[model samples]
Target: MNTATGEIHELWEIREEDDPRRSYAFGGRHGQFSFARIMAMLAKDSGITGDDFRVFFYCGIMTYEEGGATAKEAAEFLGLTPQATRRITKKLAEHKMLLVAEIIGRTIKYRASPHIISALSGRQQSEQAAAFHLPTLPGRSGSATKGRTNDTSRPVPRTHRPAGTDERTAAPETEHTDDVRDPGRPGARRRTHRG
Candidate 1:
């Protein structure tokens, strides 16, 4: 503390290497997720449970990083029985959130839908999409503008802007939006809402 005036200081070294507000893993990059599908999967009407979410994302993580995996391998890491893993994978596949890629011996490999989770860059995903002949996945429901009819979004109050983004002159608040690609699905046409 300064004896003459009250002040607080923090060191540059104190900054966190990874931003805690966003999710990142071994690659130190943001992992993509489909807002529409995620909300749908978690909705009461979707019949997906927390366990389903776990298993689905686990397969995506493995697929994004290591191509793909069998239920047995995922089970070992996720601490579930191989049977349970298989069942979850089956359910997720039926939901179109996962796919049966291939089989080697008696094990079936699974890949997550590009709309759900992806680690590949947009171009990489595009190549995989063509090679895999994967269908372009639907993102948010309805047309871009049509979906926002309820206007669930609210403009950020001026007082709450992030530290580095403060503006000097008064400006009108507009709906701030960003479009994130649906992994490898090249033809996706919906806009995702972000705060």
Candidate 2:
């Protein structure tokens, strides 16, 4: 310690062999994508829903050097119904955003389009997707539970009428005239005023 000067110096500094900018994304690691194109596809009338985006991301991230995942795989990994997952995957594939990497028996695997995302180490490029559990928000995939809860804390309507105001005072009452000239029954009044 320098008691007189009293100054702190860096313990150590990091050195890099390659430029950080040189890396596509995530420090030049895998799972990179073209943001511009993806945003365009997600615009209105794109026919792609948020669910489709979710599945697409999952398949893309899971794309291995030589293989990709099927709709079933995506559904399992994303906690979505297989049918819903299939719908999303098919829609993306039809739009040419995803490529049919291969077909095993009746199962069709998908890869991210090279333009959309580069495989982590996969020989093939493809439509991209990601992993990690997402909250079951209210959207394409409806909530599993009824989600109906009685919230008594909510702001209650103004049940208490203001002082000096009743139905008649609050809202002006319209008076109806009776035809006394007509020789009808004593109580047979056509119109009457409400209290």
- List lDDT for all candidates, in order: 0.67, 0.63
lDDT of 1: 0.67
Q: Count the backbone clashes (under 3 Å) in each candidate.
A: 0, 16
Q: What is the TM-score of each candidate against the true structure?
A: 0.50, 0.46
User: Tens digit of lDDT per residue, candidate 1, span 32-107?
Assistant: 6768767777777555677777888888887867777788888898899988889888656644567787888877
Q: Write the per-residue lDDT of candidate 2 for residues 40-65, one digit (tens) a residue.
A: 65777555677888887788776644
What TM-score, to 2 decimals, does candidate 1 have? 0.50
Clashes of 1: 0
What's the CA RMSD for each of the models? 27.9, 20.4
Please list the residue runs of candidate 1 whose C-alpha ends up more than 4 Å from where it truly belongs after superposition. 1-29, 126-195
